[model samples]
Target: MARPRRIVLLRHGESVGNVDDTVYEREPDHALALTAKGRSQAEDAGRALRAVFDGERISAYVSPYRRTHQTFQSLGLDPAKVRVREEPRLREQDWGNWQDRDDVRRQKAYRDAYGHFFYRFAQGESGADVYDRVGAFLESLWRSFEDPHHPPNVLIVTHGLTMRLFCMRWFHWTVAEFESLSNPDNAEWRTLLLGPDGRYSLDRPFDRWCEPESYGVTG
Candidate 1:
């Protein structure tokens, strides 16, 4: 195949941080484990994906985080039919280091006030930073397409922010559009289906935290 027929972007399931941000103080963000409900959610998403795929071969790229790895494993795709790689570029936006829950909350408020796209964490990356890397990763993805035997279906197991940024870059969305869309639910995945003309289209629109038309006007 040249370009994949479908690109599946998935957010990792609920992790310790999802239920309790305080875990960051003691546990590294990359090491956070998924909760029981998260496992169930991933399993359910897996079943749904398998049904859509009907046992087709997949080329999978997963984030390096523990939770993402766990999510990919829970997807239950047949290993013999899937070629998977641990993609560091798909990792969650760096938060600098271990965090204090209260401080993180305060920073998040600041981020929202300042604007989500450009707002940088105290010692971490802004949304645009993640976009750059995801764009770079796309180059690699396209390069793989040069091989005639490349799988027709692509799967990405990653964090919410990265997943969103991947789409923004791929679809050439503006900063305002990026800010308007909310993150996907844990274990949720979006399908980007290839059109007859070779362009990709998302199966559904994302829920917005803010109105899309509000951006890019000056007084």
Candidate 2:
């Protein structure tokens, strides 16, 4: 019999800094808080996920970022059922010098960094760093599967870049492939299946959105 494992990648809702676009890494990281719109988004995301596995057993993991944490709360999950494990590996790619740039400038910088995610920050992290951290976290999660009681669905709430990397790694995506898979919206869930022997297979393609017209399709 194949041991079953499904890891669900969830990106956190919008944040105030995300909207204003002035938030480069804050001194104490106060900029990471969720904005009103983000809160609403989180609530919707939570309810949507809850409905998917309404009565099914599930476990959750979260990045330490405030936005990601708040997103999890909005979902209405029972506290006991949701385990708040802080996986730094799941943190967003450090924008470094570009953290506090205005919207236009930020967009340019972001585009430049789009595919070369492995690029490092002056005092922060790169896409490669995020991938390494998530890799470690996934290893730990795999260990948890050793216990027969491990839940069937494990939800992970994290940042946009990190979530992208998670999807890329699980899909065995190359550099070009990773760039093609990036997107900003939440509400859409990326699913992956892990067999008992420890190899992963794609149960569903990366883009399973009910409404794909909103975001143009990517190969």
Candidate 3:
């Protein structure tokens, strides 16, 4: 498959749920809206992206979640030039039932002690499940790359975990390597540039939780 000139992976700005975990307990994840600060952040991100592209046309794949959609809308890109599509697979990890504060704290502690990759929420999904969906998404992306009409540059607006899982699947990283990586900050983006060799490489470094001396183990 012919790679796109560049792939920009962006996390949605802070949502209402980001400011208050309890909001997740009260509202569905898909319905959560962005906060005022989140809106500002999204605008800033859009400006930054515009500066990076320098008036080039790009395609956007946005998560179906309200916050993600809102973020894309806030980007201020030329709608006539940029094609936008909703991608369900780009949604955030399902958390199932609305969680209580105690449950949320307990689960965090357990996941920290054990592992985030394998931890499954009650009636929800594990990181492995997300990885599976991300892998499938990549397959679809590759097919798009083969299309002559596909855009040369692509933008993805998704969740932090989704972004991480996409990178993991794209790079074929092991669980240990995945564990070492940290999620990008809200409204932050990472770029993958296709090189002359026809392979894509990350443009920046990520924070590593696990050091080289302690591979496969938490620091």
Name the best candidate (by lDDT): 1
lDDT rank, highest first? 1, 3, 2
Cα-based lDDT at residue 74, candidate 1:
95
lDDT of 2 by residue, 75-113 (tens): 788776555676776776665544545654655576565
lDDT of 3 by residue, 1-219 (tens): 545689999999989998888887788889999999998999999999998877776889999999999999888988876888899988888878677867878887888777778998877888989999988888888888887777778999999988988988888777777777889888999999999987889999667877533455441
Across residues 36-141, which tens digit of lDDT does each residue of candidate 1 receive? 9999999999999998878888999999999999999998999998999999999999887989889999999999888878999989999889989999999999
Look at candidate 3 and tell me the lDDT of residue 30.
94
Candidate 2 has what TM-score? 0.78
Best by TM-score: 1
State how far residue 196 of model 2 sits from its true place (Å). Answer: 11
TM-score of each: 0.96, 0.78, 0.93
Which stretches of model 3 miss by more than 4 angstroms? 212-219
Assess candidate 1 and give its TM-score to the true structure: 0.96
Residue 12 C-alpha lDDT in model 1: 95
Clashing pairs in model 3? Answer: none
